[model samples]
Target chain A: MIELNHVTKTYPGASQPAVDSVSLTIPEGEICVFIGPSGCGKTTLMRLTNRLIPITSGSISVDGKDIMGLDPIELRRHIGYAIQQVGLFPHMTVRDNIATVPKLLGWARTKIDARVDELLTLVNLEPGTFRDRYPRQLSGGQAQRVGVARAMAADPPIMLMDEPFGAIDPINREVLQDEFLRIQDKLKKTIIFVTHDINEAIKMGQRIALLKEGRLIQTGLPDELLNRPADEFVKSFVGADRVLKRLNLLKVRDAMMTNPVHCRSEDSSEKVLEQMVKNDLAFLIVTDRDQRLLGYVNQYDLRGHKGHAGDVARKLTLTVSPERNLKEALSQMLSYDLGILVVVGEDGRIQGVLNSTTLCSLVGSTYDEHGGHWGRITAAGRIL
Target chain B: MTTYDFIVRNWPELMSLAWQHTVFVSIALAIAIATGVPLGVYLTFNRRLADTVLYLAGIMMTVPSVALFGLMIPVLSVFGHGIGTVPAVIALVLYSQLPILRSTYAAIRSVDPAIIEAGLGIGMTRAQVLFKVQIPMSLGVIFSGVRVAVVMSIGIGAIAAYIGAGGLGQYIFNGITQTYDAMINAGAVAVSAMAILADFMFGRLERTLVSKGLRRD
Candidate 1:
């Protein structure tokens, strides 16, 4: 864990501190995102943790040891750091950049070579394709990946990332974020991430610490801040879409209804229609014996049918994975004008169903769980 | 007599003068690089002295080379090193500093701050950052500076013959006094050939020495 106790940093001649007396703790294996407007000292706070800039007062400790007592060079080698610029050395090949810390630690030639290849694989870059290529040869997204790979060169237990994906295009940023999250799950390195983007904080952070004018305003889980902002500053910072943003943190499985009324593909159309009628439903899902989704049969399609339900079943063009976020599912539903969506597992087996009503109730219950009194009052007001 | 005949007749003498010329410029350029590069690097750390020192080197360059050689004669006489090769070399060394120093200073300063920050952030000590990051990145620019100095020194070294330093310049000065057009032609042609050769060699050296990562082509 990295702990900051009343840590403050005042520039030599500045009137106020860049990072005021802020106290926070980033527990091990969690990404604590520091987010605020520019000049809010979010970046300064990250620098202080690595001793990139000296603190004016207070103390910082890493894993129960004071960082000040450790040699800065020794400290840095053990703590990986990546920045917005992706400041890759232009003179070195990608392999060399990633090998920097290992070489510094005096690892043998074969070991460093293997480590470089291993890290390249971890970052999804082919060693044969990228090892000899220079930084200039890479696109912005690739360079950032290499930058991240280089930081993790020595497998440091902690990492400081300042908007690592900030320079990437939106589509690419989401991809890198998901891939990084997948990697973080496996590595479980303690991380302190900095970004001015709230959406990124929601997506990347396990806990979000919001800052304002060099002071810590609130630090909590992403859902916590979205459901209950500490003040107007944070509310506005999280934007008016907090309700929708909160959905991004939830998976389709979290709100899915299990044991949905579905008919096997070989079932008679009459039998399928009877089942749909029994459930008071307008449509019936057709599945194989293994419960794999084949399609759906609607009442209109079954009106004059006298064959197997599979004969008239139309393919469900839009389907979401159980692991996908609700926000994506919501958008998928809206774009397709779907009132209901089928959730499937990796093998295409129908796991459950998510409908609009169930999604809304999940949102409303999330509001209630977080003591979102205003949200509930508004919901009640709307109902009335 | 034809210039070719003049060259063949005086081939041994010409080779000796050419060898002497190469030695004088090579030694002077070596001294200049040894002193100037360090000064330029130091100024990067001490910005207060940079403008003053660079301005001084710039002023030193404005003085005509022939006049600088004359000025060096009396100054060095005080140190018991008056005239000839010593004075010629002293003048050449001073003349060479501007390009070498300015290039080193500019190259080092132009290195991206982000790259330096990355180096330090990655746990390299200050010296390691300078030697490994700063120096390697600045090399192409620094070498270009050295190239300019080399070409400039070759041209200036010829004028050193006015102070009794032997070179192809010996042929030109002797030809001027004796009114021998062939000797002057031979001297002028040989000196121009030497300068071109030096420039081409340095170009090849730059390709060999500079990091392939830095090359555009």
Candidate 2:
């Protein structure tokens, strides 16, 4: 457990403290992220966790012991750290760099080699391809991964990361973040991750502590924090566009328009139109035995066909998973040149329809005053 | 018609003397690096003593090469020392300090604090972090300084022949006294070659080692 008991820090020239007298406890195995706007002390708090910057007043403790009293080197040994600007030694190869910590502890050559190999695998690096390579031989993301492997080498229970993924490209950042989250689950290490992006915190953090100008403004789970932000700063920092971010998190079942008007591919246009009109929907999803969307039919497509609904329903060109990121649904609609998308289960059963209006509405309501309080169904069926 | 032909005809003599000049420079540089790099490292770490150290190095830098020899004469006279390769090599060594010191200071100071924290955080002691992390990271810059030092050492090594420090400088100084242009030209060209060779060798070493981790593959 990591605890900050009224910790505060003031730089020589700055008038105010970087970290105010605020207390917080991060339980073991929980990924607690500190997030805020620029210069909001989120970075300062992470710096304090590792004693990178000295605190002007108050104390921080690890596992109920005063961190200041402990030998700084010994304390750091059990706390892994990585930063946005990865500073892998330019002269050392990937293998030697990862083994740096183990070497310091005077581990045997064989032990360090084994640990380096283990870290290379853990960080998803190909040992054969990357081990003998120097820092210059690796790309930005690869170097950062090496940084993580080096940090985790000592297997420190507490990990402090300051905007670790901030330097990578968007696609790479997403890939790395997902991989890192997976690693965290297995390690169960208490992590104090710092970031300026709320969406990242929500996606990766088990709990989040939001700070503003050196003060702790709010701290809660993603759902709790989103539903009810503590104050204006919290609301604004999480921002009004959060619903778009939430779309990535929400299950298709939660956002899907269930009981979609259904028709068989062999159904005639006239009959499909009747069902579409009855359901007040222009489109009817055509399904097979397993409810797979073989096709779809719009009321407009029903004008000429005179037989059963099955005769006119066109085959669906695309299908989506119920658990897929909702953004895919929006993209699927645009890609298929259709006004709606079909949500399918793992068994290929059509779960429901995703209309453009609903997708737009889901992405737009991030402005809601109470977000994480989503347990209370609002008038729009939006979680408050 | 060409000096290259003249040198070829006098190849045996010129080659032997060129070997001597290389020896003179190598010894001088080894001494300078041994003394200068450590002093610079110490001065950089100790804030209070930095001004005094800089002032001392500054005074040494401003002392004219020839005047320094004259000044050392009396001191050596009292100590009863001979005036040959030792005194001349000592002068060249003193001249190589500024680049060595500046680079040593810059390389250490410029290392990112975060990388150092990561090293220590990984359980490395202060010494290990310095040698393993800080030093290697700064190798590019530090070696560049070493390159500069090597260039200056070779170039100045020719000057030591003034005090009978056996080297190529003797040819130049002797040629000047006798107004023999061949000796002066030969000495000047040989010194330039040494400087270029030293620079090229160190540059390649820097790229292979220090720069390997700095450049993205």
Candidate 3:
């Protein structure tokens, strides 16, 4: 665990401290994001943890040892760091860049080589194709991935990332974020992430610490900050549409209806229609005997059909994964003009159903708890 | 006689003079590189001092090579080495300092700060960052400076014969006194040839020494 007790840094001759008296603890295997507008000391706070910038006052301890007491060079080796510019050495190839920390720690040549290739693969870059290439040859997203790989080269227990994906375009940013989250799931390093983008903080941070003018305004889970902002500053910073932003934090599994009414494709249409009517469902999901999704039938298709439901069921063109965020599921529904989406597991088995009404109610319940009239109005409009 | 004919007739004499001239310039260059490159690197950590030292080096370049050689005679005579290889070499070394030092300073300073920051952030000591990142990145530019120094030294070393250093410049002085056009032509042609050859060879050396990753194409 990393702990900062009453940290304050006032650069020489500066009137205001870059980081005011702030205290925070980051537990092992969790990601805590520091977010605020530019010049809010989020970046400064992260730099102080690694001793990149000296702390004017207060103390920062990583893994229970004070940073100032440790040799700065040796301390930095065990703490991974990545930044927005990537800052890759143009003179080194991708392999050498990732092997920087390992080489510094004096690892064996063979071990360093194997570790370099392993990290390249972990970041989703093929070692064979990328290991020999220079940083200038890579696109922005590819460079950022290599930056992350290099930071994790020594497998340090702590990592400090300053807007690591801030330079990529929107589409690639989302892709990189998802890829990083997937990697983080397995590695579980205690990470201090700094960014100005709230959406990124919500997506990546397990706990979000909001800073303003070198002071932390609020610290809590993404949902807490969105649903119950600390003050008007946080409410405005998270934006007025925080209720919608909450959808980005929640997943299809969190809001999806489980055990949705379904039937065997080989069942008679009359029986399928009876099941749909009994469950008050407009459509019936058709599955094979093995529980693998085949297709789905609506009441309109079954009303006039006199054969097996499998013969008349339209192809299920749209489906969502239970692991996806609700915002994505909602977008897919809107894009396809779909009222509901079948949530499927990796094995192609139907897991749940996410419809407009379920999403509206899920958002609506939160509003009811907060007594938010605006949220209720918005949720009602979305349902219709 | 034509320049080519004079060169052929005195090929052995010409080769010996060229060899002596090469040695004279090589010694001076070795000393300059050893001292100047490090001095340049040192100056990078102190900007105010760098400006002063670079300005002084630039002023040294503006002095005429012959006049500088003339000044070295008086200075070296105190050590009983006036008007020969020692004084001639001292002048050439001083002349060679600007290019080598200036290039090393500029190239190393211009290395992307972000790259150095990353190097340090990833746990490299200051010395390691200098050797592994800064120096390698600066190699291409520093080499070009050395190439300039080599070519310039060859041209200036011919004039060193005036101080009795004994090189290709001997032919020029002797030919002028004896009014022998063939001897003068031979010396001038050899000097130019040596300079061109040094430049071409250093270009190839630069390609090999600098990392392939730094190459734009």
Candidate 4:
């Protein structure tokens, strides 16, 4: 665990302290994100944890020991540090760069080489192809991956990341974020992530600490901050579209309706149409005996057909995994003009159905419980 | 006689002078590199001191080769080593300092700050960062500086012959007084050829010394 007790930093000759007295505890195996606008001391606060910037007053303890008591070099070696610039050594090959800390600690040559290959594979870069390549040979995304690998070389229990994905293009940034999260899931390293982007904070952070003007204004889970903002500043910072943002935090399984009305594809069209009518639905999901989604049968297609439901069922081109966030499911639905998406399990079995109504109600109910103007807006939409 | 014919006829004489010239420049370069490179690196951490030292080196470079060689003789006469290889070497070493020191300082300074920060952040000591990171990264640039010093030293070493230091410059001084066009041509040609050869060899050395990753090609 990392704990801060009234930590503050005032640079030499600076009139105001860059980081004001702020105390927070980040539990082991959790990601605590430091987020704020530019020059808000979010970066400074992270630097203090690693002693990259010495604290002017107060104390920071890592793993229950006062960091000031530890040699700064020894302390830093045990903490992984990654930055937006992706500071890779140009003169060294990827293997050498990643081996830096291990070599410093005098690891056996064979062990360092093995660890280098292992790290490259972990970041999804093929070890054989990238091991001997230099940083100059890597693309921006590849370089950032190498930077991350180098930071994690020694397998430091705690990592300090300052906008690790900030330099990548939006498309690749999301990929790196997901990849990092996947690695973090298995490693469960205590991480302090710093970013200025709020959407990233919600996605990567298990808990977010909001800062403004060098002082932490509020800290809580993404849902807590979105649902119950501490004050007007936080409410505005979280933005007006926070309701939509909250969908990013929820999984498809959370909003999907289970036991959706479905019929076997081998059933007669008349039978499928009867099922749709009896359920008061215009469309019926068609599935095989294995419970795998084959397609859907609509009233228009079913009325004129006189064969097995499978023959007339329109092919289901879109399906979502239960593990994907509701935001992604929502986008797929909106982009394809889909009213409902089949939630499929790993075995290709149809586990549930997520419709626009269920998704809206899921978000709407949360807003209603919070007693906000958004709840009234969603309610009026129900009339339409 | 044509320069080529003169070179062939006095090949033995020219070869000896060329060897002497190479020796004088080589000794001077070794000393300059040893002292100048470290001083250049040290100056990076002390900007105020770097300014004063680089300025003095620059002023030394502006001194004419012959005049500087002349000054070296007087200064070294007190040590009973006037008008020979020692004074010539002292003058050449002084002349080579500016390029070697300036390039070393600039090369190290030009290294990406982010790379250095990454090194330190990863728990390297300041000295380790300099040796393992800054120095290796700056090798290409520093070599170019050494290359410049080499070409300059060769040219100036020829002038050292005027102060009685034996080299290809002797032919030029003798040929000018004797009005022997063939002798002067041989000396000038050999000196220019030597400079070009040194440059080419150093270029090859740089490619071998610097990491392939840092090479632009």
Model 1 Cα lDDT, one tens digit per residue, A159-184: 99999999999999999998999999
DockQ of each: 0.73, 0.47, 0.69, 0.70
Off by over 4 Å in 3: A257-319, A341-353, A364-384
The candidate that achieves the highest DockQ relative to the unseen native structure: 1
Candidate ranking under lDDT, highest first, comes to 4, 3, 1, 2
lDDT of each: 0.88, 0.77, 0.89, 0.90
lDDT (tens digit, per residue) of candidate 2 on B1-217: 3566656676677777788888878887888778777876776678667677666766887887777766656666665654776677777777777777778777787888877766665667778877777777777777877888898777777767766777778778987998878777887888888789889988888887764666544
Q: List model 4 lDDT by residue over B112-199, tens digit each.
A: 8988888888888889999999999999999999999999999889999988899999999999999999899889988999999999
How far off is residue A253 in model 2, in Å?
A: 3.1
The CAPRI-style docking tier of model 3 reads: medium
lDDT, candidate 2, at A213: 85
Compared with the real two-chain complex, what DockQ does model 2 have?
0.47
lDDT, candidate 4, equals: 0.90
lDDT score for residue B180 of model 4: 92
Q: What is the TM-score of each candidate against the true structure?
A: 0.90, 0.80, 0.89, 0.89
Measure candidate 1: CA RMSD.
4.6
lDDT of 1 by residue, B94-189 (tens): 988999999999999999888888888878888888988898889899999998999999888989999888888888989999999999988888
lDDT of 3 by residue, B1-217 (tens): 8878888989998999999999999999999999989999999999999999999999999999889888888889899998888988888889899999999999999998878888888899999999999999999999989999999999999999999898999999899999999899889888999899989988999999999988987
